[model samples]
Target: METLIKKNQAEKQLGLGILIVVIGSVFLLRNSGIDIPRWILSWHTIMLGAGLWIGYRRNFQGGGWLALTIIGAIFTLKHIVVFDFELSRITTALVLIALGLYVILKPKKVTTFKNYGQANQSDFKDLNS
Candidate 1:
């Protein structure tokens, strides 16, 4: 348990450090008259960063971060590349697929009910017999 906690802490710290470096680099480049793309500084990019940070912090166990990351990437791509079809439709389809995959592939929890004050599995088995 201690090792797991330490690992999570380390991941969080590393994520924070990377975020700081990226933000600083963006600012430095902008200040140096490097024509940075508008999309790179937009809210979509922020969403992407936030999603990545959340995923890293949580060790990519859940779907919230994945959803955010997908949305951000799709929107960012929209800005960079032109698409003939509707972006909303594509986004919705992709999000649904991701959610379905997560639901189907995520680990299932094993629940064991202990008999402290109530009847146990053995009681049910005897009743059946």
Candidate 2:
């Protein structure tokens, strides 16, 4: 009971953090005098997405966002880094291919439904009973 409560509380707090980030982002973006178009704005989209995902997870619902985060991080890094264009393109292609396969052909949920601090199962249990 206590464990469940703590888990729920932690999730709730994480959700609140995400919400704060989203709200803060909106305010900051509005205040910043930039030429970036609102329609293609990356920060707002990411902020809103993170907030929604975290809110859903607070209720024990899962989303395939962790995988998306990995893909997004790789793409963002590729965009920001000043590597050779050909090398960057190749790396980006490989990353997209791998991530696309994981998204489409995954055997099961990659992450176990538990706290990151908890121990992970090292062996699979066959349950045919």
Candidate 3:
């Protein structure tokens, strides 16, 4: 889980750097008639991506990434996207709720864990015995 956090941080930093470059390029080269800048989703996309990445990285067994993603969506992607309260918000809310319920109720698919710590096989056997 600690390694997962580090990976998330690395990905977030990389995403942020890419975002900065994208914004800079868009602004600096605006007069050149290139239209690719319209796709950047700012903080919403960045944070949302981070949440999703972290969640998947840590296997989403039990954590707060969904909450983070929702908050990110509200803060970052809210104004950026066209808000259709009836269609988009309600549907998304229901979907998220369902996903959360499923995550909570369903059994974990795999229970095995790979320990990469310094403890040797003898130490593990001793502990188990």
Number of the top-ranking candidate, with lDDT as the measure: 1
Candidate 1 lDDT tens digits, 4-115: 9999789778878987898899889999999887888899989987898788667787878987888797887666634456455466676678778878887788677666
All candidates: TM-score: 0.58, 0.35, 0.41
Which number leads on TM-score?
1
lDDT of 1: 0.78
lDDT of 2: 0.59
Off by over 4 Å in 3: 1-32, 36-41, 80-129
Candidate 2 per-residue lDDT over residues 22-119, each given as its tens digit:
66786687779654435334653564365447534644234455555555455444444344453345666766776687567654647766677457
RMSD of 3: 9.1
Backbone clash total, candidate 2: 0
Q: Which wins on lDDT, candidate 2 or candidate 3?
A: 3
Task: Report backbone clashes per prediction.
Answer: 0, 0, 0
Superposition error at 117 for model 3 (Å): 29
